[model samples]
Target: MITAQNLTKRFGAHTAVDDVSFTIKPGQVTGFLGPNGAGKSTTMRMIMGLDRPTHGSTTVNGRPFGEHTDPMRQAGALLDAKAAHPGRRAADHLRLLAATNGIARSRVDDVLELTGIASVARRRIGGFSLGMHQRLGIAATMLGDPEVLIFDEPVNGLDPEGVHWVRGFAKARAAEGRTVFISSHLMSEMAQTADHIIVLGKGRVLADAPIAQFLGGAGQERTRVRVSDATVLGSILSADGVSITQTDAESLEIAGLPPAHIARRAALENLDLHELTPLNASLEEAYLALTDDATEYRSDRTAVAA
Candidate 1:
């Protein structure tokens, strides 16, 4: 498991990571999410011992990452896909890492095959494509077969098949009781891959909870109601706190009310209901709502003349 207690980092006069505390337990995939400049990379760097925290502490498997005798064998991270030497052959690079970590050379081939980059293992890193680089980075990360896996944008340049494989791979690793923590801007993939989520904004954690709880808490529940007379049903549902929007001639989307309450009120009014479906907010919607004020950069949506 990985733990961070009051972790903080600062560069010169700017604080990148604030007093952050989180526990990434084993047997689960925890997704790290945030807008740009939210200090996610800084936190990950601290966890990997690449950057020293200005205050607080972080540990991997109960100790600081650098304190581990065999750090690679305890935790593996893919912070940057271009971390390897551009001139080295992929296989040779993995072999070198294995040698330094006292890992068997045969394990390099195993990871190469596992990441589906065995065919290009003998190729120079400089000639590899971005997708190939990501795969190679993942191969290097698995060379030690560490129990804790940290991947930052593992699917950045991957194709659909590669993305699917990575999603499944992360889930599989978590299923085996390994600590899997991933940071990505892909909300859809993260929604499917993560059991829990940690959202950071402006160097502070905004939300940390199970996927369902986070989604449910981010926005009000909405329901779609289809009736014979959309106008009449909308009028009937409108109240001080309730909001109703005419989605179509025959349907109304509602909020601030439950489906059962709507159904009962419709029954009391003897209005025939065709459909009353609850609209669960998507992960993207929830994320946007939660981080709407937290985003450091905002783009204008004004239309431009051709």
Candidate 2:
């Protein structure tokens, strides 16, 4: 398990992580979520002993990361997939890391095969694709067969098949009682992969809870309605304390009102309804709503004349 005690990190006057505290338990996959510049990377760096926290502490398996005699055997991370030497062969890269921690050279081939990159293991790193690089990085992380694994954006450059493989692999690892923590912007994947979630905003811990609880509560239910006149339906729903977003000419997504209420309103107004569907609140929607205020780089885009 990984634990953080009021973890705080500051660079000069700029604080990156602020009094954040949480525990990542074993036998479960925990997701780390945050908006850009919300200090997700900084916190992970501190846990890996790459960055010194200005205050507080973090530990892997009950002791500081630096104090571990065999750090690779305790915890392994894949923060940067392209951090390997570009000139080295893929297998050579894993061999180098394994040598540092007294791991057998045979383990290098094992991980390469496990990651499905064994065919390309003899190729130079510089010639690998983005997805191949990610595979190699994952292979290196598993070189020591650590009990704790942390992956940052593991699916960033992967194809659909690769993404599916990672989701299954992470869950399989957790089922084996390993501590698995992953950070990703792909909320849909996280929704499927993680059992629990920890959200950070503005360098503070916004929430830490099970996936179901985190996506539940207020503003959880939203419905989509398809009518002959979406504009009129939107106006009617808006006046009744419902928020409406016109998706297209015939469809409007309504929030703050149940599907039954919407159907009743449509019947009362003699509105021609084609469809009235209850839309599930997705993890993407929840993340955007929770971190709307914490987003660092806000965009203001407007249509331009052709």
Candidate 3:
């Protein structure tokens, strides 16, 4: 498990991460989400001991990352895929890391095969594509066979097949009772990949909960109702605190009321109904609602370019 207690980081006058606290439980894939410059990378660096926190602390198990006897075996991280020397061969790079950490050289081949990059194991890093570099980075992380894994933007340059492989790999690790914390900007992928989610904006945590709860727990339930006479049903359904949006001439998107309530209301009014569908708030919707005010950058598009 990974535990962060009031973690904070400051660079001169600017605060990058502000008193953030959260837990990444084992046997689960926890997604770390945020907009650009929202402190996701800063927090991951602090957790890996790459940067010291200005206040509070983050621990892998019960100790800081620097205090671990076998740091790589305890927690492995892929913060930057390009951290290795660009001239070195992929296999040689993994060999060097294993040598420094007293890991057996055989583990190098194991990870190379595991990450599906063994075919190009002898190729130089500079010649590898962005996707190949990502695979090589993941191979390095698995060299330690660590119980806790941290991946920052692991799918940045991956194709569809690679992304699918990563999703399955993360869940497989969690199934083995390992702590897997991944940070990404892709909400649709997170909706399918993560079991729990932590959202950050403006250097602070905005929300953290299970994926299911995070998607539906924040806003009012919306029900889409298409009636035969939306013009007549509009005034009849309009009441105090009940919001209704007319989607079309004959369709209305209703909120602040249950589907059953809308159906009963239509029945009592003797109105014909065509569609009564309950629309669940998607992850993208929930994320936008949560971070609307927290977004640091906003664009005012007053002009269009041809």
lDDT tens readout by residue for model 1, 1-306: 999999999899998899999999999999999999999999999999999999999999999999999988999999999998999999999999999999999999899999999999889999998889999999988988999999999999999999999999999999999999999999999999999999999999999999988987766789999887889878877899888999898899999998999999888878899999988788899998889898998777464332
How well does candidate 1 match the true structure in TM-score terms? 0.94
Candidate 3, residue 53: lDDT: 98
Candidate 2 residue-wise lDDT at 266 = 83
Instruction: List, residue by residue over 192-271, the lDDT tens digit for candidate 2.
Output: 99999999998999889998878874264788899988888788778656678998999999888889988888888899
Q: How much lDDT does candidate 2 score?
A: 0.90
Best by lDDT: 1
Model 3, span 1-306: residue lDDT tens: 899999999999999999999999999999999888899999999999999999999999889999998988999899998888999999999999999998999999999989999999989999988888888988989888999999999998899999999999999999999999999988899899999999999889999999988887768888888998887788888988888999788899988888999899899988999999987788889998899888887666465332
* Shift in Å, residue 294, candidate 1: 2.3
Q: Rank the candidates by TM-score, best first.
A: 1, 3, 2
Clashes of 1: 0
| Candidate 3 vs. true structure, TM-score | 0.90
Q: What is the lDDT of residue 176 in candidate 2?
A: 95
Worst 10 residues of 1 by lDDT: 297-306
